[model samples]
Target chain A: MNTIQIRNITKAYNGVTALDHVSFSFEFGKIYGFLGRNGAGKSTLINIIANRIFADSGEILIDDLPATENMAIHEKIFCMSEADLYDTGLKIKDHFKWIHRFYENFDLEKALKISEQFHLNTNLKFKALSKGYQSIFKLTVALSLHVPYIIFDEPVLGLDANHRELFYSLLLKEYENEERTFIIATHLIEEVANIIEEVILIDKGKLLLQGNVAALLETGYCVSGMAKDVEDYCSDKNVIDSDELGGLKIAYILGEKSAIPQGSNLQVSAMNLQKLFVKLTEKGGI
Target chain B: MNTIQIRNITKAYNGVTALDHVSFSFEFGKIYGFLGRNGAGKSTLINIIANRIFADSGEILIDDLPATENMAIHEKIFCMSEADLYDTGLKIKDHFKWIHRFYENFDLEKALKISEQFHLNTNLKFKALSKGYQSIFKLTVALSLHVPYIIFDEPVLGLDANHRELFYSLLLKEYENEERTFIIATHLIEEVANIIEEVILIDKGKLLLQGNVAALLETGYCVSGMAKDVEDYCSDKNVIDSDELGGLKIAYILGEKSAIPQGSNLQVSAMNLQKLFVKLTEKGGI
Candidate 1:
């Protein structure tokens, strides 16, 4: 069953629309990538679903019911934003205690273990921790919340390579055990492409594309060959973008692989999500 | 001529070594990716070179002369770190003015233009800006500095996808026009791999690998084939890592691609920098 649904949701601030007729439904027990360019209303949509912000029109439903600012609905969903979650004056240990008390599903042991892995100092105040450590702290809290639907907006911002990998690994483990739904909004598309089951692309406050990850990849291909060959092959097709490096030309095109012309020496491969995002956003034709 | 040089630099805090015997020299006009796992001394190394911290031993020289907190050397090198750079009370516009007055090469017009692209509020107090906008402000300053050498430590941390791409495009344009040296320390390796001419990998306070980007890619290859074929080809080689999907197996190995046994149905491709990094660091072997 779909865990969350949004229908023709629209929001505006001072006559500037932040979300316009956005509609999508997220399934349960799957990981989804909420992707978009900057100011594409990803955060706005998430906030509206979480009931942290009001939409000007339409409806949002959680668990097949209207999702207003109801405490029960809010309890089942957790949205971890990119901004620092902890108050500046609170000590790390105190913050942990507060989270434990606030969320009935909070796993204190798991939080402690994660803190140990990250080598976080519980005595240190929020402002005293390094940026990387602060991110780790917030990640631990979010993971331990154990909500039915968890949303992470750019969760690995300050994490290093090792920590970032660990975050994904932990998410996978949690998914395997609990089967909860996860929505991740991030620009690091390639890194998480393998982990996400579905992708939803938003652009300029509107829904651009939404589908199964594998299905999207099947239709989007990157063709590389000689400049003349690529130009000729892409002339009649939807060539989203093209780039030349030395004598080789690579064109991002939308079509079946069988359509590629013979004798072109073309190497057609699935487009990495980041490359696809760049091409689509630049062309504004997704 | 080398723009910056580090010779056997070592740094410690309360007897805990942050950087150990690190040595590298950056050329005058190339983009370098300073990569490492968390706590691998990337920041320590850059901080020392920027004269913000002192090395316990060894020397840092810019233009063949020691970079010892001297105004002449400092003025030519710009280091934009993830740390907060502005006083809390100052307005964003005032901070820009302060930076313009302090840095002789700062371009006020370019800074203003970048601010507009990022949609930053010039009237907002430094402390009032969102984390993302704060990062944008710092990036704008760095772009406008126009220094001979610039070091950016995770400069795109809070930026959205569109702004991040814009930053990269602007960086390329700046490099092409001015031929300035730039060292970007980031965990988002794949995003910058295309633009970086060289890469420096660090792990646990030690240098792991350093080489030209093209040469590094040539050092290893990814071989994909049937499970048995992949296993047989990788059995006797230095298989850095391997992943299996259904009936297909892919192995990342160091050594010449031609060394693989014939009749293995092996197809070899270049290894991605990010995948290689995860394999090398996460496994603790290369």
Candidate 2:
């Protein structure tokens, strides 16, 4: 099996359940967007998958092999965490060299080339780089590693619009060059809406939705019109949320969408990914 | 004059020029989006306006009154900085009390109401709140103050979608209740595109573009077609950037858009705020 299978994983901290019987699988050669609200147990799940922490119960399998405390599976997955983990005194080039020595699949030449593309000064110490540069450095290491499954947590935390565009284009180029699984965990949904093929959304420590991006987005839509007409149309629909401005109204509806009635002044539009995520999670995690 | 006039502002750090003879005026009763890349002197200008730092040259006038070390003008302008300046040991309610005692325009009741709306626990100490909740607490204080001018620097740093929506709605409500000026310095351009009336963009420590959001967006657009057709059509336009995907090409053009040649098989669409920002800044701050 070429996949990371998470089976019934559960974790608790100080008696508070963070993950409750969560089960999911990341298949090979796909781009996934892992999304959730803050404190939604996303970090906990990522930590468990990276072998940084153990779950209270259940297990993780990378390619059908046990992942718990398994040193053999270390090279199969690499997680670029949000927190800085490099030594502040070491220069960027030194860190790259250390990574190359530690990981058998680290591509030194590719790392150097990517660094030059991002204009990252390899001679600057880790502590001397700005926040955006620090994020760039972490992503550089992740991109250079020839791992089967790589996860990026808030990869563009402090990046500006230009650098972010550059990163996305480079990521796309890398994905095209090789077919591997790339799981991105980020809050900037709109920016990644077009890049990610699949989405896994968790809320309150439980899986809410997981499916192909196109199919998931097709499951819901929005209706806008006069307040009374929109309310009447939404009465028999699965309305997630709505907004009112004077007499105008717009209601976000989930489930199989129905066609508008004839002679009605109603308008239907497809809801974007961020709006869908917000509406789904705002309803207490449906 | 109900305006904050910044005349010939200049600043440097250890001989490195951060702001070089920059001048702009922020009129009252409007919301402005202050945007720029990293190390673009945005924070330096904000700090100078908030009286946290002194400018190397020039002066700031709030409604024609000198803002330099002027204690009497303190109540007129309030800057909600990204950094945490409150005492971590104090409870959320205690901090509210302190603000009420210090600023005569502070509204304790409004602050409590806003906190309740965000589900922030007033009994918890500042240190105990999560990052999202910390942002909520800070925004609550900023929203409740009846200052004529308010500035928010990365107001939605760690906030989730629901909280961000709530904050924007609340900000609009506050603005509707009383007309005042708001200067929001943030990298999230698309989110604030509708909220801000005008935009002030800086790059390389100089003013790049400043104008109303709607008007500025009209100044640029994107055209898509075959590579040869797009290249031919862009020969006379002010093309900012172009992307080639296989045989298709999309060229981003600035300035007055001329009519497309008849039967050229080219499609035109308006460029979004984030895309415009990226293209403008990526071209070496033109």
Candidate 3:
């Protein structure tokens, strides 16, 4: 199979488990949204997949081949994390040249082209670039690499709205040009809602849900009306969360949405991706 | 006047200007969104208001009293910035006690209550907390202080969806309990659109626009249909930005939305805050 498969991967840091037998797979070509709450071990899983760290148990396979510490499959995947790995003293263009020499599949022409599109100055040193530009630099490298799988961890961390929109459009263009797997782990769910084809949710180092974005959004909805009316309508529904404002009430439900009764005062609305993630991952109190 | 009046504030670092004759007033008892692109001098202006940095020219007034280095007006305002000002060695509870002595209106009781509501372990040291928890601690201090003015610089930087939602509700509750000025500088425009009453936008160290949020959103809208239809409809309109995908087109326009023709296929929709900000500030090309 042309996929990156994980079989019971478990990792721990000083006896605290970060991944508890987390098993999942990324098919050959699809854009995925990897979502989770803080301290949910997203970075841990990404690092393990990139071979930056070792998992205590289980294995990662790429096209049925072992992925752990195997240089043969190194050119197949690229992970752009938040941590700065490039030399601070090196100029942007110089770093691109260095990466071209290191990775067999690195495309220097594409790197310069993307840099031009983002208006990134190639003459500036890594340390001189602002936080937003630094993110642009990292994403430029990820976009330039001809890898089958690329993971972007917080790609737009410090970007403004214009730059973020530019990045998304560029990503879509790249996806259209080639069939490759792109996994983005970010907190800005609403912005990526329309871009990602599928979603993989993790909570407490365990896989909670994974499916098509449209299918998942279809299951979650909101029913709002007068306080008493909302309560009566949601009495038999699967209410995940709710809010009350004086006489107005809204109940967030997770299940097949039913038709409103005749002369009912209730109104139905689709639950957005961010709301679904929050309601499913939130534990206990506020 | 119960407001923070910035009178022709001008500041520069080295030879480059950060804020050039920028003037604006944040009135009392309302939430305002301070929005701008990266390197647009938001932090520079915020630091001047907080008295952490001085402006080369002009003055800041709180209720008609000079705010720069004025000890009398210090207690009237509190700025919770991204930079950490607390002692990293001290426990959360200990830090709260220390803050109690620094500010005359510090409410220790409210601080403890807010911490408990966030499920923050007050016994843990500042350095021991994660990035999300650190943001929560900073916000807790800001909420506990009974000041007439408060500024939050990227308050939700490392926070997850649940925490961000919790912070927004807490902020609204705080505003409801006491009518005070709250200035939030964030890149997440859509999330804060409904919460803010007014908006202050700056670009390239200059004030671009400032007005009521509802009025601003009402002025910006989008017309979408066939490429030719959108072009024809927007030819006389104030089109700010546009996108073309195959045969479809989306033209973002700023002005009164006129009624479409009886046989026209163009559809008009309200423009979102993020799109408005992007179209207004984006220059040159993608």
TM-score of each: 0.91, 0.89, 0.89
Error of 1 at A141 (Å): 2.4
Q: Output the lDDT of residue A4, model 3.
A: 85
Q: What is the C-alpha lDDT profile of model 2 across B6-34, one tens digit per residue?
A: 89999999999999999999999999999
Once fitted onto the true fold, the runs of candidate 3 whose alpha carbons sit more than 4 angstroms away are: A222-251, A260-269, A283-286, B85-91, B123-128, B222-252, B260-269, B283-286
Write one digit per residue (lDDT tens) for candidate 3, span B155-270: 88767888899999999999999989999999989999979999999999999999999889998898988999899888789888887767999888888988887899887767
Q: Which 10 residues in a row give candidate 1 chain A its minimum summed lDDT? A: A255-264
lDDT of 1 at A173: 88
Tens digits of per-residue lDDT for model 2, A108-127: 99999989988899999999
TM-score of chain A of 2: 0.89
Q: Fnat of the models, one by one? A: 0.59, 0.54, 0.65
Task: Quote the lDDT for A44 in model 1.
Answer: 87
Task: Go through the candidates in order and give each one's C-alpha lDDT.
Answer: 0.84, 0.88, 0.89
Model 1 clash pairs are none
Pick the winner on DockQ between candidates 1 and 3: 3
